[model samples]
Target: MAEQWWRRPVLVDAALAVAVAAAVAIAIQVAGEPIERQADFLAYALGGLMGAVLLLRRRWPLAVLFATVAILLTYYSLDYPGLAPAVPLSAALFSAAVAGRFRWAILVAAAVVVGGLVARVIEFDMATLPVASAVITDAALLVSIVLLGETLRSRRERVEAEADRRVADERLRIAREMHDGLGQTIAAVNVQAGLADDVLDKNPVRAREALQVIRQSTKEALQELKTMLTVLREGSETRQPGIDQLDELLDVARKAGLRVTSMTSGEPRPMSAEVDRTVYRIVQEAVTNTIRHANATTVTVELCYAPDSLIIEVTDNGTNTQQGNTSGFGLTGMAERVSALDGRLAADFLPDGGFRVRAELRT
Candidate 1:
């Protein structure tokens, strides 16, 4: 996969370094300044090298800034004419501020620019209007660089935060699928296996039928698990079952010795992919629980499409029994999916000895 631009901040920093170096070199050459016995050569090389040091700006912002400032000061003290103070300092100040070293950048700015202004004041007799103007211009330019860097830094931070939130949301969605869809399929397989075990001696024919149900349930579960993994790990598009696949789900329950039926009402118009898939999962989980926990002889899965809403209902006339914890992630996951769509899920145990699951989604 192609790397995101933000993930490669160092590359941008490196390019900035090369640009700064070239700019500094061109400025000195154009100034027609006198070289102080090869001291000018030394100053140019060191000043230009400060730009390349920006490669570590994010890792060592304060150090890079201090190093650039010290090198520029040392270069000027070599007595080279037309040596500008803010030439190399610009890149360093920008790098530091953008690296989130606000305190360090501020401290460096105060120490350098404020100190320069105070020195000019002390030398008032020798400092002309031109000198005062240069000092003010240099200070203003440094502040501008720092301000621009901070602005970009804030934008990058906001981008990163948004990316993190998206990742978290995707994770939650995947978790719900695993719990509601795959978990119920596995549980159904367990139910079939246990039934086969119970009937092995009393009725060999019935035991074989139970084993067949287990095989089919596990096979479907494996396929669904594979799809879930593909979606999460590879980020590849995987097919999600929807209302069209409701008959297949009911077939599995029928084959497992449960009387289950599916029917649709209203002129069935198309639903959004998310809403369609959520409807399937809700019904699937309801059916699985009916067979596993509710000793139901018959269960009904129905879909109703209204002008403004899509409704789904799963009902079973069976005694709701529990071997252990009756509550599971099935209902919670369904609720979460419906809530995401601004819909509602109603799942409850009927007082007359049955269970019902109904979901209503806005069109």
Candidate 2:
């Protein structure tokens, strides 16, 4: 991904400084004013100094603007020429606007506008239509520069907000993944360890199978931990679960004594990686909840893919209630994932002495 525009503050400000200087030099030359006091050179030196100040505009925007305007206004007060006002003043206004201090920027802008108009009135022998048009043009230029800066400021803020939101979402996702994957795997290991201990002498083979399950669960848990760490370091993961993992998921539940079954309908078409992973997570979490809390013997995972949307349902005939699962993001994380994709999640308890977690997902 490309870096944010504001990340390299020096480079951005420097480029802007150079552009402003070039444009101002061109404008001053276009006016064709005589160099009586070497006013053109003075405009160059003074405007160069002003543009140099723009390099630090973001740090002290109002100060930079005030200083630039003060210097320009002083030049106008000396009655040297009219070439020093528009370019430097417009640059200052833009810098202030970009800084997002609208109140301060506007205050400075108002002062600069009034100063520029007064300079125009004093320079002219008479306030004719041409002179009035010049003043209006300067005012328009002032508004336009500040408007551009304000627009950019708003855009930068929006981009930053979106970036912050994405970061928060990703952190939540990693947390939820660890909770679901590691939490369930560890729970399964605990259950199997207990089972192995219970039947160690009478049922040696069964105990060995339980031990095997525990070993596998720990390995899978390690893999899940690795995935989360990879995401933290690289901001991405490759081992995302998909529809293909449903059978293995159900098998794991069966091994954990849940007697889970899975069913799918409609032609399974291609889905985005994110959607696939999220679907698998929802299923995993649902099954894990059933194993840990449902106290039921059977859990069912069903998937129905339509032309437009996909529906997932995980139900258990366990009498274990799920109304007050506020310990962690049990269903809350699933809801966030669903909401991000503009999907719907209904994870309430069923009335028929069972619990159900259902989600309808969209691309």
- RMSD, one per candidate, in order: 3.9, 4.4
List where candidate 2 sits over 4 angstroms from the true fold: 1-8, 11-52, 197-207, 226-239, 264-275, 304-311, 322-326, 340-343, 348-352, 361-363
| Per-residue lDDT of candidate 1, residues 1-363 (tens digit) | 999765688778778788778777776666654544333677578757877788888889888899988877666566544445575677788888888987777778777877677656774444578667967787788888888899999999999999999999888787777776676667667777888899899999989988877887888888888878887777636677888888887877787667777788999998888888888888888887787788788999888989999999999997755511367676777788789899988877777878888899998
Clashing pairs in 1: none
User: Pick by TM-score: which candidate is best?
Assistant: 1
**Model 2, CA-based lDDT:** 0.79
- TM-score for all predictions? 0.81, 0.79
